[model samples]
Target: MSYQVLARKWRPRKFAELVGQEHVVRALTNALDSGRMHHAYLFTGTRGVGKTTIARIFAKSLNCERGESADPCGECSVCTAVDAGRFVDLLEIDAASNTGVDDVREVIENAQYAPARGRFKVYLVDEVHMLSKPAFNALLKTLEEPPPHVKFLLATTDPQKLPVTVLSRCLRFNLKRLLPDQIAGQMRHILGAEHIEYEDAAIGELARAADGSLRDGLSLLDQAIAYGGGSLKADDVRAMLGSVERGQVFGVLDALAAGDGQALMAESTRIASFSPDFGSVLDDLAAALHRIQLIQLVPGYRPENHDGDDSALISLAERLAPEDVQLYYQIATTGRRDLSFAPDARTGFDMALLRMLAFRPSDGATPAASGGQRSAPSPQRSAPATPSAPAAAPVQQARPAPVPSHATPALATHAPAPAATPRVADAGGMPDWEALIQRADLRGPLGQLAQNSALRGREGNTLVLALQPTHMHLAVEPMVSQIADRLSEVMGEQIRLRFIGDSQGAAHTPAARAASARSAAQSAAEASIEGDPLVQALKREFGARVVPQSIKPFES
Candidate 1:
């Protein structure tokens, strides 16, 4: 006999055997026990998540010779036949293949007949969403009003595609995907029952790789067992799943935390030697960073049962700050998707590594002096002049005096300055418009409008605001009442807000300003390179032009 895979060998025999679907199982069991069975049942969930499995179990319970109960006796002829897929009464159809109107019509015609050999004729249609619109329409009436002894069990991954007409006719039970812990627990149980030797780390890896699908997890385990011959190890499962070792991920993260450039490059090269997936390695790094963040936020939440390989991760987590963990996680997460755009996997991995290093916070130390510092003038600074033109003089500004240590406590104690008073023409005089908006706690577009709009002189029971055309467009008409109410609060009386567009001002467009700043900086850098001492020294030493290109911020 051919060897049966773990998925099929350990398939759930009854509702009790199902995992991660207690809610659905309980509802169905109560319905069966109370004799409140619906003629048609819809089971919806992702693949390998027990949609069809539950349907089969429900069918067996409905037609079990022992009577309707949550636990059907497998010894009964009806249950035995159904479990073996040989029951004439249980018609299993794959709607993916048979989705035509004619195929649906055939099923509807078959529904008119009596049960072949069981108490009820059960039609189990898998992937029912694959059926065409007209096909769904053709079976709607029959599915809603099936014969007393007929039961229809429809299963689909994408239930949204099913028409409301068909959906309304059946009782829907949505099976949730199995959680990682739940999948890991089930795997342990299966491994113990199969007398297979396995490590908890190996089971956890398989569970994560399965991504919340029990059948997929079992299939992965079956493959791992065959690969390992008998005893499953973390390395075997990692290799089979093409996942990077947790140690390598921790090494890269450690290098990142220490800000060790040479070590980072060396570790990356070693990782590339194994032909490990660069994307998955980055993903593992992100996951490690997230775990570190969790551990930092909530002490004693560390995975005490972690395998030996996780020691480096815990140490790295302790060494790195919480903010740095969050930053690296973000960079690695974003860089993983951008990896495909690189020239090669190595280059992609290198770029991702560089990105992490680039954003990594410094430990109050200057970077190495070997690599020349790359600096760009401030955006507010004017562009540089040519040789013939007079060089622009650097502007000097007075620096604020440092706060005295004795005054620091007083400064901290003082509240922020109150907003300016509004020029009011009411009997009470001017009101504080800034205080009103602050009191209202305005946010988003409304807050932006209140921040930008200037309070003009007010008329009787009216507050006038000098708003730009753009601000007026955002705050006028739509949110006028909300702004008025806030103003009313500040004025200590009811006031109307009128938005008068400012014709004297030119609105600054953010995009145009950014483009102008970039252009000016590029021109200034080109001019500055000729005057740079390092560029002159390089020209004299190596006869090189010392062209400034690919200037990146140095990581300290």
Candidate 2:
């Protein structure tokens, strides 16, 4: 007897034996038991996801000599014949080979006859979406209203290509892709029954490589068994699959977190010896980083993608900051995309790793490899000396922190516990407007309103604020009332407030003054970095260009 492949030998003979796809199985079983079967049935899903398999099982359920039940007795002639693919009443048609209208017409013409050896004649059309438009049109009416003695079982990977009219006539069952654990469990069952020696780890590798298809997983298992001389070993499977082991992947990540370039290159060399796909290596790196980030954020959160203790990932999460992990993941993904364009795979991979180290945020707040402690300039002195440029206009800004122009009006304020509230100064009995706004701790729409309004002196306990025409929309009653309330609380007096709307032309509001100050600081930071002697020397020697967007204002 010829040796049969594992996929074919272990083919599910009954719905109960089918792995995963419980949803499709349950619906079909209920339909069959109730004797409420539809005349036409459509099974759709991706390749090897059991679309055609379920169709055949349903056919057996309908024609089983044991008397039309969901569970067909294997001893019965009808069930056995269907299992062997030689049942006289089951017409298996490959729609891909015969997609013309003539073929559809022949199928329709044959519907008048009854089953030759069973209770119902079943027409199984595989890849039904391959049929031409005219072919579908010719069969639509007949498919919708087939003879009582016949049943149509149509299977397709691409249901979108089939006309909606054809789709509406059938009872559609979508089979879901099997998860890695499900496929691994099935592989273990087959190996145990076959009396083959195997490691659980080897089975896991095969399942992941299968990419959600049980048939593909079984086929890979067969090849792996043959390759391993009838015994599945983890090492042999990893070598045969040309995949990098998790240990090697973790080593690369360790080197990255330590900022050890030499260790990273050494690990890369060792991994390249297996001739593994560099792009896949990058993917592994990114996946590991993502898991590390999840662990860091959601304490005690373990992902199901990999098996066993991920203590290394947890350790890395503790060692590295969340921002660093995110930055590395982003760089790895971007590198994978650009790998094909590189001169070689190793070169691309190396550059991507290097870029991750090089492009870390300049802000001291973000952690670095040097023990998460970075030295930054004091807040008061961080902004560089601005170039002497003529001032645009005299804009008295009460608050230097600029709220964005498009920000919505916030009705109240809720400052965080650690935030320091600015002290309200008397300033010789004339309320320092900017200091007052900061002291009020106004946020949201109220913040934006105060940020954009100019302080026009107070008269008779009524402080009048001037608003530019562009900002008149924010001068609403609710926000104005909150501003007055906050001011009253801060100044220790119930000062009534009134707004002078749209009268001041091009007058600088507090937000505009803040924006101008920020622009100047950004310019000075960029100029200082660009003018550095070390930076100029590096640019001349290595042809390194500064990334402009990476430059942000620093406050000392």
Candidate 3:
């Protein structure tokens, strides 16, 4: 006997054998058990996502020897015949090959007659969208009003091309692309039943490479098993697929976080040795950054089990700043898009990593400096303009670090006051939080969030903030962490944040205070304008009147 491929050998025989499609299965089960099944049905989805398979199973259920049921006894003659694809009543059609009016007309003509071997005749047309307009039109009336003995099951990868007249007459069930985990689980089940040993990581790599298609995954598995001499190994599978390990991607990030240029280049060179697709590598990096961001911004967010990537992701999430994570994510994705334009794949990848290091948020800007002393700039090898200074002369630091070329907004942040001389509270009260926010020069949405929140007081390591109930929704993950980080730097202590709704309905926030001050200034300016002696003289001499709307305030 010849060997059968895993995909064909392990094809789902019934609804229970299917995974990741409970919604469609439930609907079909109800329709069958309650005997309210529709005459014409359409199953639409991407390739290898069980569109035709579901249709076939539904056909088997309808004509099972045990009677009409969601579950059919496979031993019975009718069910066995359907499973064997030799059932006289179950007619499987491939519209891709026979897409003509004549073929559809033949089906329409045959659908009028009763089933030859079962209670109902099933017409399973795969890729129904391939049918020509004339064919679709010819079959419409029969499809919409097929005889009670006939059932039409249409499957297609593309349903948009189908005529709406035909679509409106059938019950449509859209199948979903299988997730990587779902694909991996099914792979594990098949490998166990086949008594084949496989590394969990290899299964994960195959599942990801499948790109949401179980059939594609199984095909890859077969190739991988043969490639590894009948055993699955992570390194072997990666070599076969030419994919970089997730650790190497994480290593690049770890280097980026530590601000180690040499280490970053070393990791890049190591990855380049594999001669893998640099674009896919950058995609993996971007995906890792996305997960890190979710961990950082989403409270109580659980990480997905992708062959033990959770712990490393969590570690990186804590090591890197939220702003830096977002910046890296953007650069990674755009870098992948612009890879073709670069001189070479490796160079493009190296530049992307180097960019992450170059435009770093805290290259020289620490949360708090000691003794108000900036880190001395590295010695320049270039000759000075005058060429009079000695090489041993101190490299004086007089200014903030020069902004990196092509730096993004995320890289610009407040350089907090020295930790040696932290800002202290006055009169046992909050240290004029509004003034502190201004002095620190917080920017962007984080600044606005701080301005809108009034400091209530502190309890232990946490600070209570009074915010309007309406604006409380703005106090989400990123904003909360950013504000806390900035404040802790200025206060010289780690502070957790807690927000409470301002029930008093009073304007106590910095924004409200600033608005009140502006209003007062405007009123004073308007009064001064109204009482001007020159204006009064002009009005009297020309019989003119001051325009109330034109009494502007000199606000700066």
Q: Tens digit of lDDT per residue, candidate 1, span 200-252?
A: 88987898889889999999998899999988999888888878667677767
> What are the per-residue Cα lDDT tens digits for candidate 3 across 113-145?
889988999888889888766666656878767
TM-score attained by model 1: 0.63
Clashing pairs in 3: none
Off by over 4 Å in 1: 298-300, 308-314, 360-556
lDDT of 2 by residue, 1-556 (tens): 8889988888898999999889889988998999988888888887898866776787789888888888988778888888888888888877888877586767656777777888888888889888666656556767767889888888888899888887899889887888989999999999999999998889877887898999999999989999999999988998888777765677776666665667667888898998887887888788788887887666447656465536566556544556667768877987899899999998998888777655454322221224422232223221311112221322223113222321221111222232355545565566666778888888889888888887777887788888877677778887889899999998889988878875562267767877877766666556555644346457866898989677775553
**Cα RMSDs of all predictions?**
20.1, 15.8, 21.2
Clash count, one per candidate: 1, 10, 0
Best-to-worst TM-score order: 2, 3, 1
Error of 3 at 68 (Å): 1.2
Best by lDDT: 3
Query: Top model by TM-score, which number?
Result: 2
Please give the lDDT score for candidate 3.
0.76
TM-score of 3: 0.63
The candidates, ranked best first by lDDT, are: 3, 2, 1
